[model samples]
Target: MRFIPSLFTLAVCSSFSIQADNAETAIERITVQGDLRQQSLQQLAGSIAVVSEQDAKRTSAQHLDDLLNQFANVNFSAGASRGRYIQMRGIGERSEFVDTINPSVGILIDGIDYSGLGITGISDMAQLEVFRGPEASRFGANALAGMLNLTTKGPTATPEGKLSATLANYDSRQLAAQFSNSVNSQLGYSLALEQQSSDGFIDNTYLNRDDTNNIDEFSGRFKVNYHPTERLALQFIAHLSDQDNGYDAFSLDRNRNTLSDEPGQDKIRSKALALNADYSGLGFADFNGQISWLTADSDYGFDEDWSYVGIHPDEYATTDRYLRAREQITLDYRLVSTPAGQLGGSDWVLGLYVAGKDYDLNRQFWNWDLWQADSFSSSLERSNAAVYGELTTPLNASWSLVSGMRLERYADIYSDSSGNAIKNHDMMWGANVSLNYQVNNQALIYLLAARGYKAGGVNGDALAKAADGNLTELNSKASFKPETLYNAEFGVKGSALDQSITARVAAFYMWRDDMQVKGWLNPDSGPQFAGFIDNAGSGRNYGIEMENRLQLHPQLALFLSASWLKTRLGNYITLDGDNLSGREQAQAPRFQYSVASDWYITDALTFNLSLQGKDAFFYSDGHNARSKRYELLNARISYQLANWELAAWTRNALDKDIGVRGFYFGNDPRDGYEPHVYEQLSEPRRVGVTASYQF
Candidate 1:
């Protein structure tokens, strides 16, 4: 897949930027820790994107999932909506049981890791940053494929608040309020609350299930900063949130428009605290340290008799519980602008990281006074120390070369509820090099290559016990191996026609060794399948990405992005000697394209429109019964009066019937059932109004 944007397109975009605003004026820019001279998104040698607060307001995004779904390179898994489980560039959440993510993509909120679905949603975020390629060489080990970084709003100097109320067509009503205050010269605080209720879109096929869903959320954040002196400061942050909401409907048959009797429900809670301190201009080095902790708990339930026709009325309830907690601490020392040495002007960084987590899960069926519980528990601890440095040397007036490397060690252990134990230890190395040539101030081209890795572990749920003994170990079903990726890319980023427009294009090839696949098999207790982690033989992913942003006069702007991917797997052999060749990776569409446009109209009135399209994807490894291609269109209209703004928006305006359904490990065609037993449908035409104020 090769993408080449014509010069005519560039010229047209440049003409539209004649009355544009400064790109960095509305953003809070921060330096990339290791490379202080490189631009945040434009000059970096990796794929990166940033979402501004202004953009969020234009879209009226009330939550993190709304923002993620609008991005081109991102794909959301159709699940129960406890929270969004995402797949980026073909990797993430490969399993349906126990809410297990693929472990290749890393998610962080305010620099704190959110390991599971319990803590994935951030209710009051200010901005979200996504790095598309292998950022692990700079961010961490877990970001083998990419990274998602979330930033929350901090306390401001304002001392006012606003209240809003809304009503919609879907039997929906909403109310929200926000307040901000400055406690003193050094302390600031902000608080927010929201409540929403709706009568769902589908009918509950079973009895005794809730047809109306309601959600109430509360969030508060506090910050205290001491700028007692310049160049040295300390900041403290604390955040808390609670959410309770009813699950959306999942269709059992798309052709028949049948819904489940047991509509899922969820209860979720989360909290986080962190402290950061920094000192610059030290005689020898600069020092920075941060420590943070987060915890989440969730409860989910579904009806067991929703599908069976003749089951007793008493056997109508079933449920699952997933709980997770995580903590992390980090410290770093960097030597900048060293004096009188061979490495003068070069940067060096040494860091130490320590983290730990615990996971608990249980599932059961509810029949009058009879309860069966299948439980699993595991613990994880990790300690890593690394030293990394980058050096750039000038070859000529038009060329320069940069090189860097990092070395680290990792160790982990997994213990199940039955006392069975598995441990792993390994030392890994990662490195990168790039050659950059300056074509002019408006253009630059670079070629780079790098390697990334993800730690391996045993299936936390693949344990069996014997009745005669306290615990027994079953032979490991799959010899899971560490996943490693090697990537080579060539790209260009630049601003043209006097910085009125910006554009980027890149082409790359990435290969995965020992990939992990969640092979599904029908279980005895229910109709759904459980995820069994196995080592996929081998696979290759190659793609091209293109993005453009143009300012069509002062109050108008436009953005466009597209991705083309070609992925294949081979050597996948099951215990039965069956081979999986010519199979497409799950949830990875071959072609995706997106475009968005905005018209300010006036300072008081704004209009926005966006569109996204994706090609068909194979839900099963056999490349049979693939999902149909789909497209979604969204529009927004806003009007401002003094300090308040009112907006109306519609999502999925076309009401396209989108479905993500397929057979897992084997095909199931019941006599009276359809080809796909159960399928999750994307939300249909949704319309809402919102009001916001700033003081």
Candidate 2:
């Protein structure tokens, strides 16, 4: 079945039918991550990909995760269970908590950290930048792997507004509205709202339900910009989101599985507010500061009766609340500026960060009052401060060098379920060096290497296991050790054919220390269960990423991207004496690629087609592996009138079948040989129509 798709891909690339091959168009130069202004894709010095609002609209991307999942060079183990994580240069770890995200990858929106991934109100975004590798030296602690920056749209020059509605299969409906206006010359504001709901695609094998698998989400955002003067500006933004969704369904014959009780229900809500002030051109000095507050509450519960009797004889519920309040102030001073001279450009930025979070987890068994587990409460208080400076000097006409370093100190205090205190402190330093050479106005190449660090915390899995076993008390293992990575990259960006085509290629290698892996346990019960986290071993990831855009004609364009990765563990130490050494990483695949093309068929009509492919990986413990390769096709045809635009799109056009495999508990040890099952689950082939009007 997979071979047929491979042949089809080869045929498509081999065909000489130049329907619209090798075509690209030049767009405006945009500054990504609030620092560097990339004039063209060819001039970017790092591994970066930009998706504009126009691109988002053309693709009909409903969520941030959906957009990143289709892009090349990015892979994530995401679903109803595993939260979102950025996988670039092959570094990804699953962290299920909200107050702390083990993202080697960081996410930012308009210069503020977007700490919560479960909240769904990420609409009205103007641009999204995906940066990989050590280029994340500019962000905070969560940038060990990469960074995702989403910049929302600001007030328009005129009073511009849009209303859009979409209807799809599976009883799904979506409505969105955005309005922006200038209250006066110095004040402006924008407001947006979005609501979406869907009847899920999976059927619960136990509950025998249809609509019970549905999801509902609502989100809203408001932004106000005040420019008291040309050099000083103030921005205030607030957003709120709520979601209700069904957990992943269990596989058929789930009675034998330990965790395979009936499907669960999840309710999540979040609020974010930020106020920022920026002042520039202050006699060779500039300042930027912001204060933000974030709050998230989640409730998830599962009933354990539909599939099996006596196993998990009651309903289990877990509720968590996370609150984070942060304040950051930064000042930059520059003493030298020259158009063409050495030691002309030197800058320094000093920043102070104060942050604190309150985290609490509660668990209870409904039927058995004695078998209850709940957190009295827990809180993590964190604070950090840093000062960084960068100096860019031009050695000659075609050569330049940049050097920067940062010094930081951090402190953290954790209160356990009983309000017992645990404290830790650390001081860390980071540095970066980059050398660039420009061949011409349209080409540049550079070599970069930098180090990144991510702080660690308590092991939720281990704690949960010990608590369920009715242990008297457990001493906290001084939080997991921080994982660190050193990245080395070489890249070149260039354009040709009168700047109508742009291309970029980069090769990177990273060595990670103190890697984390999950270890499962064996239990004797109606439902067998136990699991924990361990610093299993070290790992290495190396990969090459390349993307190209060519403008073949005025009406046609072509874009292609592919990433080849080699991810593996260098050493292994098992917690349970399993001797599972020298095995490939469990859930990470080694190959992912994508291709897309756009054609302007007429003045008011356009067509887009794209295909994404992913390789296979082991399902269970790297012993019983199941191949998970699938090719997905998507297409959109859009039309525009004077004041309205309409699009008809189809996702998963080929209706490819995807399988998620897992293990099952067996009555006898011998019966476990064939107890593995494959759940033929998918998002379904969806056809949608969208209509939008502008005023």
Candidate 3:
């Protein structure tokens, strides 16, 4: 599997010369909406990936997980129904059970912030933008490693509608609809709704149920645009998602058949509203502002024993569940200099941001033991305020200097039922400077330097439990120091061969101070383990990424992306009294790549084929377990005539055996409870068909 991508990439590149005459097809120009102002993808000085609506439809992706592998050096951790965390450049959380997280990666949907909440369904998404490096100056603390931004489809002026249906293996099914229309010249609106469900791949033999691990999700989005005047525009959006999924994935035999009797659930209910405004009525500058609010509730739990009562005579019947509720409010206002408002031949942007977020959690672990029915409740609140500014000045016709900075203040209050209370406050800042040299209309070269940071916090749960025993643990390690990273990068982006080929290349080196890493804590007496954050003195990560697109013919296009990464962890001591220094960081795969082709066979028929693969890496810190490297193949063919379309798709066509997550523990009693590696497998081969109608 590791040799596949090299051969595939070479074969595709060699054909670029054969179809020289047919290489006139031009690549589409893309706009980056995640930034303060809309800018061309090539003009932005960053490592980014943008997946358009058309590309998503071709892949038949209903969820964010489906498109994550298309980006270089991007990965997700699957500890629940879906991947609960997103990792970039070897940084991000793998799981969050008892601790409140200050995430290294940021997640945004539309005009609202969903940072640290993983991701949501993208049934009506317009595009997905993934920033691969730190965006400290633009995004601040939440984007220490990078960020994911999702934009939903907006309102339209003319009446249009679409209905789509899909069916697949494992009793998977989906139904969706989208419509847009205008009430008048000044008002327009759009709506999208979707429902998806499937009897998951797991088979719970003990419970005699195939749906013990299942998926049922409903999502909707609504948007309205009011353009009453030329200088003022207002857009309002509403978003909702309801999910009820089961979590019975892991097995003692490392197969799909599970023995858990008390299958747990992974459920989330969310509702949000956002109002965005753009006004040019002001004389000096144009204004862009947004106010948004979101409320979400989640229920996640699992059977701790992984077996029924009778299966293991000595095992206790226990289940762990977490019920949480969260609310977030944000206000962002910015002013961009108008053409007449430029100062000293420089353009500037000034903005202010305020956000408030709080969550309450209840953990109930029920067991047959009379005194071990542990019930713990906790709450955390976060308040943030920031002021940021950016300035770009031309140094000549072919060069420019860009600089930006952000100053922010954060306060957090946390408390729990164990008589433990903690308060943390930090005033931090981030900044970036870039020098851009535009060699010509077809190419731009840039050098950038940036600094990013992540706030420190207390490990409440771990600290409370440690106080109950005489374990040798240091108080200084209980609260880690704030993390900071200094990064330097060189990049180039442009098109070539008469605009038939577009490519972007970037190489970066980063140094981390007080790197935050998860440390597994084992109880002195019990098998229960807790995870907490600790400062791993220092670390370094360097990587190179390439994104290329070639217009082989008028009816065909090829996409290629690759990343090579190297990460090293500095000296760090674990809770169990072990030293790990100069070890490769977890989840930081050495190499990752993807190659795809989209071809229009005829006027009404199209075909797409993609192959993606990654190198194996360590699964966690303080362990030697690793996943096996693997490759996956996907293909789709669609035929359209008039307003009707039919498509058939298959993913992982070869049915390769691969593991997405792994754990090393002593869970199986059959072998005297000896520790062995257990893995959660990736999806096998799946085939499906889709039908769509538009009017």
Candidate 4:
């Protein structure tokens, strides 16, 4: 429980004897894509973390969620086959049901938005940047909590290729390949393909099957780059993915063994295309334009009863199914002036964006014993137009100011199968201001204040109707207010001992108004549960984070990262008149820490060890149940010879039983509806070998 002090002491002792050097290092000059332009990570006046391709390879992460879980102040809710929902600083959705949701965090892959559905396949990645706190000035409504920006490898002029395969415990297997080539002086291309399968950890006792919760996935990507002239560059990208995974997560005993005879399926198929152009022929600025299109079809269903009819003859066997198809198109145009050359001695960027989306959803709930069924269908159309600008100027030789703002107009139309329609529109804005000071060539400090917001929308669930059975009154209760936050932060980032040691420390405080909280409500006479969002009065959150990396010796290195957070609700009362004030938010852990070390035994052999831990936290706002704190230990050993490399790895070496997600409600009919806690556990200890070759 006292991980913060332990990590701090270790970092201090390791970095105390470092000597300052004048040589530049790779970490000091790392470029980050936090905004539209690329800048050194140290120059950014925010909290940011980056994971490189080399880091991904060393960890042997098969998906984006696996890689992200290693960082500080990050966690995932794993009810599905994989960790598809992400929570940062305790601000995100915990689960998704038969209703529309506005995500707090935003996810982008190669400039294409993938919010709410972030099943990103990890392959051929260049870098991934995680920006904590509010990023509304750059990303608008989707970034109320933060943003995750992912960049893939681009086309290279040299001909290169890679082939890799992995075999692991639990009958897991993976195959992947990548190739890049330059056809001529102006044309270059890159292609990547991957396929993976696994027999999941859970078992179904009634069906006598071990693969009820299995994994099968395939993904491919292609990119093309063309340079017609010195001032003009064009790039095209396409991606496709298919996934068919099982979802038999829960059981009567809250263990890995399930009794559901009718198992569920989690499937998704997606395609994306994008084109980007950059032209520097403008008189005083460079012009950039991008157009992108994406489509996804997903099916998520589950056996609601989690039991066979033979076991519980009196209870009705129930099943729930949902299907969704979505399409989106976006266009963006921007201009960036030459740095400190025009626009009144300040660097400026201006841009305009337009986007549209069409979404359709269908849900079916059936009870076999009673022969009762409820079917619902809905369609949603949305559009957005925004204008944003940023300006940066130096007030003194060591001090600089950065200011940015975004103004957006949003419109939505929702229609349901019952002939009920709702229309909503709003105009919102967000802003950011930061002042940074350079203490020396190796250190910098900054203070920032920002505002973020999420737009309101209509609810289409039939159970959301008014108790009075009045249509007009029902429509009035179907809407919720927008949520907003004001955040203030201070941080210091720098290198010490001649760039041999790097460290960053930050403290942040945030105030939220009109906070949106989601829960289910049961009416006095309804057979279905109604899901609704209410505007909670207010809340406050504060946290501190620290990270340090030290090169202790030529063959050894050490890294430590830790976070401490505090949260409190205010004036929020549930439907049962239960006061929620002073309660901690769900999924908001108090302490998280990660420590890693790497040793090079020889020119061809290396070893890595990592330990990570997360403190206990509440599972939901409607329940008092909490999860237990857990820790994991992992190790890897790799050997390299010419263009071939081999590695062996083990995760969760200590085999700790950590509960990643939990629900505190009655799930079994045998106990006569007595509520009990059910939990989904984290992955157990697994060992594997990976072999890769490059040319």
Over 4 Å off in model 1, which ranges?
1-38, 95-102, 118-124, 157-201, 208-217, 255-263, 308-342, 365-374, 378-398, 438-443, 465-479, 523-530, 575-578, 620-625, 660-677
- Which of candidates 2 and 4 reaches a greater TM-score? 4
Query: What pairs collide in candidate 1?
Result: 206-261
Question: Compared with the true structure, what per-residue lDDT tens digits does model 1 show for residues 1-695?
Answer: 32345633453344333332553453224333323233555546666667766766555555565566556556656455533555667765533454234367777766666644423333355667777766555655666777777776666676867677666656666666666667776566666566665564554544433352334455555566665556676777776766666653444444323334445566667777787777765755556666777666666655433343443342333444444444445543344333433254543444455555544455443322124545555565655666655566657765767676666666766565647567767776666777876554345567888777776666554453221122222244423666777778877766653544777676778887887766544333233333456778777877777667778788878888777777877577653345776577777788787778889899899999988788887665543556779887889998999988888998778988665444422222233322443455655677888776756
Candidate 4, 35-142: lDDT as tens digits: 766778776888888888877765667788568656777777876777767777777777666667787877888888887677556768888988888788888888
- State model 1's lDDT: 0.60
lDDT of 2 by residue, 518-591 (tens): 54555333333344444546777777776667777888888777777776765655443456555666555676
- The lDDT of each candidate is 0.60, 0.62, 0.82, 0.80
Name the weakest run of 10 consecutive residues (lDDT summed) in model 3.
Answer: 15-24
* TM values, all candidates: 0.85, 0.84, 0.94, 0.94
* Candidate number of the best lDDT: 3
Q: lDDT value for candidate 4?
A: 0.80
Backbone N/Cα/C clashes per model = 1, 8, 0, 3
Q: List runs of model 3 lying over 4 Å from the truth.
A: 1-28, 366-370, 470-477, 524-526
lDDT of 1 at 630: 84
Rank all candidate structures by their lDDT, best first, as comma-separated numbers: 3, 4, 2, 1
